[model samples]
Target chain A: MLNEFFENAPCGYFSFFDDGKIFVFNETFCKLLGYDKEALKDRNVESIFTLSTRIFYQTHFFPLVKMQGHAEEIFLSLLTNKGQHLPVLLNAKREEHGGKLFTSCAFITVPNRKKFEDELVAAKNVAEKALQENSELLKAKADLQQHTERLDAQIQLVNKQNSELKQLNHVVTHSLKEPLRKILIYSERINDKAQPNILKLARATKQMRVVVTGLQQYVWLDNTPSHFTHIDLNDLAEKAAAQLRQELNADLLNLHMVKLPSLEADAEQIQLLLYHILSNAIKFKKDEKAEVTITATALKQNIFRSVEHKYKYEDFIKLEITDKGIGFDPAFKEYIFDLFRKLHDTEGHGLGLALSKKVATNHFGLIEADSRINEYTRITVLLPLFQTTR
Target chain B: MQKNILVRNNVKVFGNGTQPMLFAHGFGCDQNMWRYITPAFEEDYRIVLFDYVGAGKSDRTSYNAERYSSLHGYAQDVLDVCEALELQDTIFVGHSVSSMVGLLAAVEKPEYFSNLIMVGPSPCYINDADYIGGFERKDIEELLETMERNYIGWANFLAPNIMGNADRPELGQELTESFCSTDPVIASQFAKATFFSDNRKDLFKLKVPSLILQCSEDIIAPVEVGNYLQENLSNSTFKLMKAKGHCPHMSEPEETIMYIKEYLG
Candidate 1:
């Protein structure tokens, strides 16, 4: 009865010596591999395993069984004689029979269970991939949030600087105006013995008044609201050239104009911008002739003031103004646009480029300058053709 | 700091004599792997054993994926243990991948070690045009897949056994609680670090005298790799044992001990 039970059991059982020689195996084990008991006399246990399973057996199974004296629920695949893989759930234990040490193993063929387990593993891999992608998206969202916060901080800083500039404008208008008036009146009333010094004081006070007015205008650009209207650049450039020629008292101002696109912008600010650029060309002329050229082209591209503020405009106008003037060092090209920044001791209060930059920024545009030490200077202004409602 | 290193690596030190003998375990198992062989040296040498941060009962929270991603990270662990114990002129015994780990440590700090004994060491595990480390990239991938499936199966099997045998501690212990049990994620990472790593150039950097114990028919580290190490290493001895498989110290401890003793003598 015991022999019949051993031969007809549901699981296959095998015992191999420490050298991996098969010493005994149940009839069920032999039948599972399609070999009779006599045919498996010299066979080693690892011969029936698939290559991966063989590696697992040696590296994990054998060592584990040897150390712990038993290993359970180990998954491995065996190669049958018919050249097909048989997935099996294996359990092994180290046993000492008499004086010899051997390992006895029992395994049940688990084809259907292996399929289920494979599906589970595949599902796990899919879930892990999805989790990884989700985390990446979360990280991207966090980066965008940080960028927005930085932009907010920058906006606050600009607002603070604007307020401080307004306070300086107030001081220049109220505090310095009364004192300059008193000095001019007192100098005119002085005796002839101090006439030279009094004249110098009067001239200096007058120049100071002009600087105070320029400072007010620069501060007023940010305070006043902009009025948008359809303005033709060709008309504005002609008027600006005429104004500059009259202001400089030089008909030698040679203004070369090109047909430009009509765009909706602040007409007053655009005229001021044109006037300043033309006046600068004539003022800083190399000799008697002030040669200035203005051209405009339409573009279709996005404009970025900063990385956070990207203006996707349907149409844009790129205006280039080139001048044959005494250009300063190229290194000070960017610095020349700062309020009251002067590279040379020229006439006027060094506020032309600063006012021009302010007008460009107000129209959601950008202005960049390029120059050599003695060559011509080119100022490029990029503006949206049609302003979007803010 | 020294106490923290000891706790982090689960370092154990106990022996009879003054000379220090540090044993580094291989990829799959922990320091318990040296249980069978450390006994023979206990009479005359101080034995040191430790688990890598991710394996065994070492502090799992101390595991940094970036630090332990390379063999040098593990070598740093060896050096840290050496410095923690203030060991000098130590005899280092390393098994499988730890063989390369010890070699790297010795190369960096040669004064910490005197002699090296490597059991089934392979500098590289993938085959090149002229060298054969006995595996292709696909084989290692398949091994990883097999490991994943087995870990899932083992976890599933152990969960119920633990739940049902709450009253019987011995019964719970009789289950798949073996020395090779490791966290699946860490085991997979360690496997990638071990198999995908190529340490062929590092062989020339060793200055300490070494012994390479090459086992017969080791699929992981074949005979060609042993021969390659013997040729490249300047002060090294090579031995091909009759034992079969990747781990000889476990399968044939007596032969392993005999060869190690003969080399040390």
Candidate 2:
């Protein structure tokens, strides 16, 4: 009965000598490897394992067992003659026989446990990937937000500088101009017919006054806090046209108005912007009759490439004032908005378009001009619909 | 910084002599493996014993996966111990995998060491077409699986049995408790790093005098491996012992000590 119990154990059992020559093995152990007991004689225990497992046995398993005297719950795959793999958990203990050390190993196959472990490894990999993505997204958002805040501080600094420049312009206007006024009045009072050069000097002084007034307007852009209220662009366009009627020939200057959207913006600044653009259209007209078209629409896409960094918002109110004028080269488009930049003969001081750009920037908007030489010039002003704290 | 390495490797200095002798233990057990051997040399040589990080009583917190992934990392630890103590012309007695570790340390900085004693060393554990390393790749995987499954209960099962001397039961129990004290994860990593590493090409670079103590019968480091080491090493003496297992230092310390003394002469 004891012999039967030894042969018919639930798990496979084997005892190998120090040299790895198998001395004894149970019938169940032989069955597990699909080999008979007599056929397994003098066989190295490493022969039953796969190539990797055999290496494991020599380097890790054998060394640990030799030094520790026992190794428990080791997983190994037993390879059969037919190339079938049986995954098994082995618990081994070193036993002494006649003053020599031998190892007794018990093998128990666990197929479902292997599957469960694989699932656990897979779930861990997925969780790690998700955590990595979440951190990356958070980092990107924080970077963008940090950049935006820096830009806000820079805008405030530029506004402060503009106010300081306006203060200087006010001083120049009050202190120096009073002396020039006396020179103009005294020269006009002389009215000497023989001295024609005296009259020319008087005319030059008057021109200087006009230039100084234009400089004052340019400097005062950031002086007043913007009063944001709902105002119709169509009304501003009509008012601009009426103001420029003195310079424009009504019959030849054909003004077309498209249905314009109302926006929350500085009414005074919007009126000034419209006036500057309309006056420019009349000033640089090529044909006998100037046809100026003013149109306004809600910007659905982000087309402002240059100004994209300034604002994180995408929605804007775009107002385009297209003109039948002698336009400059398209390559010179970027320089047109620069201060004192004159593409054509100067009728007004070159500050008109520069001041227009300043107005758009101060309102958290952008103005760009696209043109073809001797063709049409389209000036686009993009303004956010909602008010922004300047 | 030297103190950190001392704490990290759990370096212990013993004996009273001018000549320094350093002993590095193998994978599973700690510095206690050299207890029997170091005592014999204590009167003549200054003995130094240390546990590799993550093994024995070394600091587990300092085990960096990248740093300790290869044999080079353990070699650095050996060098650190030498540097901390400011020892020169030291005799290094490395057992099992540590033999190769000492070889690597000597290779990096040879001026510190005077002689090398390698006991049961294998340069590479995996067999190739031309070379027989006595192991295939799959055996290593099975061993890893065994380590994982046995990791939790390893202390309870093997510690007592491993301290196998029957004469002193308390010594066995103490060794068992100390063996069981290692962190499971670190032990597994140390096992992987030691076993999977290959340093066959580095053997030719050694310029120091060396001794290869080949045991009579060792399944782990077979006779063929010993023969290969004897053939490859440049400045070395090969001695075959009648001792039977991989660890003669523990099993037969007197014989191990006698051979070490002869080699020193």
Candidate 3:
């Protein structure tokens, strides 16, 4: 009866040698692993485990049992002959017999405990993932808040600049225009043909009117809000060419137009921009016929003076108006774009490219002029395909 | 911020004698585990008791996980305590895992200690081909799992229930209740550090006189481990007490003191 009790014990028991060869096991041990008692006698315990569990058994389980002499409540999984998992809790003891070390192991099946442990591990991972996502969300919210604050600061700066420009316009109109009007009236009243000072005075009055009008136009462009609309550049170029023909009375002004994409922009401002640029091209022509080629091409990179601006990586339409005109020196290219900056004794106010640049900045775009002395002038205007609203 | 405060380890110094005896508790509980043992040595030795960081009331804020990831951290804490009290030629009695902690301390700074007494000590808890450390990897993992599940209980309730040591209800009850008192997170990390650490290679590095007190039937550290220490240690003697559990200092304090006194002589 005692031998039967040992054979049919409630817990499975087994013993292994130092080389991991199974020396003996109870009937219960063989039943737990679904192996016949004779078949399990020579088997290594690690063979019944999966690859990862086998590694854990070698690196952790065996080493721990060696150091601590016995290990209790160790959870592990074993494989059955039919390819099924059997989760078990192991308690092992080491003994020295005849100068050789041997280990005895007992196994108790606990399937539900394994399932519950897996659930807890999954829950922990889920909580960690949620924490990571929460931190990312907070970071995004902070970035958006910073962007809004920066935009508010920029708007306030622009508003302050606009009010200052308006104040200057008011001061210029009241102070400068009144004295100039008096000078013109006084010069007309002294209409003495015998003195050459009257002619000089008349010339000075005309120049004053031109300067004041240019200043007023500049101030108005700086302050006035533009109404944005969808505009086809092909139609815009034709309209500008027609208007220039009507103004200069030159029907033979050659304007070679290529296909241009439609865009959302301030149509009036853009038309004014085109008119100033086209008129300059026509007026500055040193050849027999005024030949100007206007072509629009999509750019991959938004390039400026000599540096590259990376506001919008792509989606920019560059309109290059090349003219075989009497171009200035390459050194004077940037200087020609400054307001009231006269490089030559020209007929009009030196404000065409400056006004074009102002219009481009208002549209969140850029304008650059490249000219070689006595060769050609290319005035390139880079505008986005879609304008961002304030 | 003061190293003195941290190094002091919230020391409870009692008794008065020519020789100083510092008691370092093991993992699971704190310095209170020596309550049953300290009184026996109170007459002839100056007894010093303190808790490791993250255990009992030893300033939990000072607990650094990275610093305390190995046995070296606890060893450094032992040296820190020695420095704080200016202890010299002290007899260091360490229980359970603190035995290795004290051993490491004596090896690093031998001047601070004269005799090292390791109660139920295992240098490494994992077994090798030639050594018997008593536990496997899965066993330690289960012990950690058991700690995690039962750390929040008013009484650990699982270890005693599983061990079936109902005869000594108060000892397990005291240990179980103490388990709930620590920060659960720190307790779990400490468990991993204690059981997973392999100090077997450092056995030959001892420079101080030592005593290995092995319990008769300890589930944690058995007799072979103590024998291994005795054989490997340069100046050490092994003694086996007729105690049943891993903590002979608690269950059999008089016997423990007898061997300690005998070893000191």
User: Cα lDDT of all candidates, in order?
Assistant: 0.83, 0.77, 0.74
Judging by TM-score, tell me the better candidate of 1 and 2: 1
For candidate 3, the TM-score of chain A alone versus the native chain A is 0.58
**lDDT by residue (tens digit), candidate 1, B58-165:** 888787665677787788789999999999999999999999999888876687999999999999999988899888898888888888889876674334233323
Check candidate 1 and list the clashing pairs. Answer: none
Candidate 1 residues A122-231, lDDT tens each?
A: 99889977996798689769878988899899999999998898888889889988898888787777766467876788778888887877777777788889988899
Candidate 2 lDDT tens digits, A230-275: 9888888787778778655364567898678788898888889988
Candidate numbers sorted by lDDT from highest down: 1, 2, 3
Stretches of model 1 off by over 4 angstroms after superposition: A132-390, B156-178
lDDT tens string, model 3, B112-146? 99999999899988888888988778777865655
**What is the Cα-based lDDT of residue B140 in candidate 2?**
62
lDDT of 3 by residue, A1-390 (tens): 987887899988888865566877888877877888778878866667653345345433554344334556766667787767777778887776787677888888888876776787568657856995798689669867977898799899999998898898997778889988898888888859568878977887888787887778778778798777889887887788899999878774688886777887888888888888888888788787678898775533322323211122335677889899888887887888898887667677787778888999888788888887677888988887776534
The reply for model 2, stretches above 4 Å from the true place, is A49-51, A58-69, A79-85, A97-101, A121-390, B15-18, B27-29, B35-44, B125-174, B178-201, B214-228, B240-262
Q: To one decimal, what is the Cα RMSD in angstroms of model 1 from the true structure?
A: 19.7
lDDT of 1: 0.83
